[model samples]
Target chain A: MESAIPLHLETPRTRHKRVPDDYQPPYPSFVARYKPSVNRVVMAYFGLQYRGTAAAAATDALAEIAARFAAEGGPSHWDRAQYVDQAGYENVVSVAYWDDIARFDKWFASAREAWTGAQPEGIGTFIEVLRPTVARHETLFSSLGRPEGVAAISGGMSGEVQEHAYWGGMRDRIPLSQTGPMSPGGNPELIRDGARLRVKAHDNLCLIRSGQDWSDTETSERKLYLDDVEPVLREGMDFLRDDGLGIGCYANRYMRVLAAGGDASEKSYGQSWWKSLAALERWAESHPSHVRIFGAAMKYLSTLGPSAKLRLYHEVTVAAADEQFFEYLNCHAKTGMLAAVETVAA
Target chain B: MESAIPLHLETPRTRHKRVPDDYQPPYPSFVARYKPSVNRVVMAYFGLQYRGTAAAAATDALAEIAARFAAEGGPSHWDRAQYVDQAGYENVVSVAYWDDIARFDKWFASAREAWTGAQPEGIGTFIEVLRPTVARHETLFSSLGRPEGVAAISGGMSGEVQEHAYWGGMRDRIPLSQTGPMSPGGNPELIRDGARLRVKAHDNLCLIRSGQDWSDTETSERKLYLDDVEPVLREGMDFLRDDGLGIGCYANRYMRVLAAGGDASEKSYGQSWWKSLAALERWAESHPSHVRIFGAAMKYLSTLGPSAKLRLYHEVTVAAADEQFFEYLNCHAKTGMLAAVETVAA
Candidate 1:
């Protein structure tokens, strides 16, 4: 496999992690667009916990995933676990760029045997996926090698890597662009509308990340990345990509800047929608995918010999309707969490 | 632990498995009875499946269960797996004699923590418990080790173990005994009147027995029983014992005959009840306890080298009320699968 076809971006200060407090984004937040051939992005965060025996299966699954990605005209774009280290969980969060959601869907629907066999029973596997335009989602990163996640996967991303100082300055310049969906009812020019919108009671907000200074060159660590990492990411993406399974979840996206480098991002967050808080809790604790991912993580972490930088943390957030803000700008059709909120749209 | 305290029944011919085709009990249909001390019997069937990784957990849990019984005064009378073996599963179905359901309930309610820790996430643990009197449920076999299931757990039972040939002769001499609850309505008459009685649609019937010639005292077999079997079994029993957690299950009881020797009870059956088929299915496929039991078995099975006489099979039965038959003799009140059924004293 060669980065020759199109490494697209120039590498800068060796793509490093930025402690959250010290981090800033230099790029203007806008509705991102892909090249003519690129139409959608597949993002995922596959995590691991360090305690149990099931975790090993996760790493093994990951390796199988990476190999698959590397084979035959694979994903147009892909990234590894470059996200910051949060306290609770170690995860492999990445993105794959594709021109058509259908092609990606086709592979997912047909490629069962190609990935890890029946998800390990003891492990936990939690996943999320999204196909949002630049206007629907926004991201920020500092000093990354070329582009990563959605930005990297999309062919037309301005491949320039910037410094932390540059990010600090850029933050003040770019007010966030619209990230919600284009309401079918058109724009609302309400000042003090008589009708009061009811705020919903449920939301799913997750901040997940791995340990500090944890990435090492040890044989196992390398194996974690090269073998187990990619396939697992693919599995997660495939999981969320399937429309049939995304029951309560509206949108699933993983942003590199949001997931990476900074200590703030070390405990990165996942923003998704659910019909109810109870529904979200159920999925979190017992969903097959979630349990499997958790199990695999535990198994893998257990093998790492203690003292290996490792702590995975999560602060789940459930919110009300009024508490969330989502919108889209000069972008295309449905996008973001709000697009799936039927009540608002109706 | 000493059998001196009215060890009750006599052991006959080292209770062993009888292949389905070869099994034939000659006693004319009759309900069994225990001495005055016997109030109810707790019967159970624990089984295994040979192919998967979780099978090891099943055997291990069984061993743990057997030890628990042996260490504590043991069941008043219990039998090793001796029921006829059908194709498909290996099971240990045995009974424990309980003079007072209260004592049994006390042990169950308080003895939870002493069992296995949080149920293993990978193994599959399924169990069934019945507290029935001699009138409600009857057992007829060629020979069985004394002290099986609830029969052994209780205070006293007839100290006679007879061969089927002897049973065949005994049948012509002994007439049918009472096999119904003492009616509060004070009528032996109501039952026999030729009035069409409606049969209920909800019922659960189980016939679990282990496989034939499947157990081998090989290294793998010993390791499996010692390491994986006990823990898995303990976990499952613990899971159901927890008042806060045993959601849909009514009761759980496991005895050696239902889980012991004779082909590892490879074709054991699990007889239990649920509010509905859907509820039972949900627990079987997704509950943490069930999954963990399955996983442990798989892991344990995978590790065993070949030449291990291992076979685990099961056919879980959920029946409609009319399809199941149960009764309570002059023995006690509120026992058997049909506990809610009205008691009628004959």
Candidate 2:
């Protein structure tokens, strides 16, 4: 069934920048394209929050999880990062990706048992898992050499895709967008156990991880980025964090990526949850903050031409309600998905 | 009616570093000490969270609030900062201070009406107002020149305070700590009004803002800080953010201070809410993460001696329930104090 949602037609209300049908992107950009056999992928975030005294214990717990993942049947790939949350607690997070749900379920069940069975005092643990169908997930990258986020699990890059370099290009690239408008349905529900809180997901809950890496830029470009582009980008990010609720943003976190040694790196990303893909698109396509961001980025890119070493990329997912799981132990109610859910008796 | 909480006595289970009565600090530090006539101070945080499209409207609203405060009998001092929240929304926050509650109430009533009466579309507004008795607030600074947070409204800085350079010094500096054990007594209760939610404060809710400024440091010292000190400091901060619930911390946010032009500055701070001053003290004195941070800081200080240009400061307040007011409009359930409260009908 063909939905009434317009496709690539600019109306009087259109505010986003659009390219003509024959327009070509100035630079090559790539998106992840998985194999046909990979019908879906599971992304799981295992988090450890702890006080200084529990550092050793938390580290040990993380190592155990890693070991479990490295077993006979486990996630295909995983990465770790560290950050401090709003409440001033330190967090170590490990993100694992699996192309198959059966494998993920087996590994997760064992890992969960080991993690919750013997959590040491002064440590809080949480798991946020998302299983999005292959058609529902989309990824874009400015460069081809580096693959981050869900792109790490892709079979290969879709060498120079035609959908980018214009507004609504992100939606056009998503396979599921062709079939239907991914409108949100149902409200988030919460269940409480002892010291743990679990949030059941709602359909069409959108998640996006948009990132920037200026670590490889030269002195002038780096200065230009830090002084010009970054400020505008930050302003946009700050706006979304503080007041995007009216536009259907559930929550936003602007985070700095930590290096292997737990030091803050030159890279950073904004991770946000939205009510639906349409809401996110509404903000991105026409929002003034994004326009400023786009202007700054275009100016920087044009000034530097192909020599610009800065990298930009994003991964977006819209998960089905049955394919998501969020559980938090001894954490404040605002942690992750808990913030958007209504608490009910278990 | 003397409380049984021990004062400066080292028992067999002592874990925190202590200084002898005659021991002298190697460097000078200052604390804010208001005049005897000023028995209390009011601090109000007015926040504007908005999407890019609503930026202009939000800015105007903020200006109106400032203008209202500037008019006939407003706050004594006020400052502004911009940040991104967990949900990816951008936030512009204005913090105002008043020496008299009567003056604050008078200004707030007018300001509240102007704010809530006509909030533009695509914007979310919130007010977190706190009034603490003079005896309930304490401030400490490593350097004498720069005054921040509550110190911006202090009569003057206390010259060479002796309560610092020890683990339990923070508690010792609070005047109210002398008479009673400031134990948390009540649960946070929430009241709803249409889209707005108000969280009534509990009895001894603790708030702390600990800041670090390495803006003026030389290359070598800055490297020393970023490499040696910051990693250790961040580890402690992360631990607290993730797992401090078992230790009495309610919430923690490690934030980068934005410059006047909305650019990230060379300063950052960890703002946290705790159950009580005693809970905070226990973590500071006995937590391993904090111990590591203290060691790193001491090493850096000893190495740099008097040449260290990094400035450190913190302000802590143990607020009475009646003195606190938290109200969020069109905000997620987890924003600020709402995360730790129980919701009830209006």
Leading candidate by lDDT:
2
**Candidate 1 residue lDDT tens string, B1-346:** 1111122332221211111122222221221336746645544322222224545665565566666556553445544543211222333333343455665556543222222222333332222344544323333322233322333343333323232222111211111111111111210111222211111323333222211222444675766755776567556645543431234553333333334343444322233444432243334434556556645654555455334444332212233233333322121222222233344333
lDDT of 2 at A73: 76
CAPRI-style grade of the A/B interface in model 2? incorrect
In order, candidate lDDTs are 0.35, 0.74
For every candidate in turn, the CA RMSD to the true structure comes to 25.6, 23.8
- For residue B287, give model 2's deviation from the true position in Å: 54
Span of ten consecutive residues with least summed lDDT in model 2 chain B? B1-10
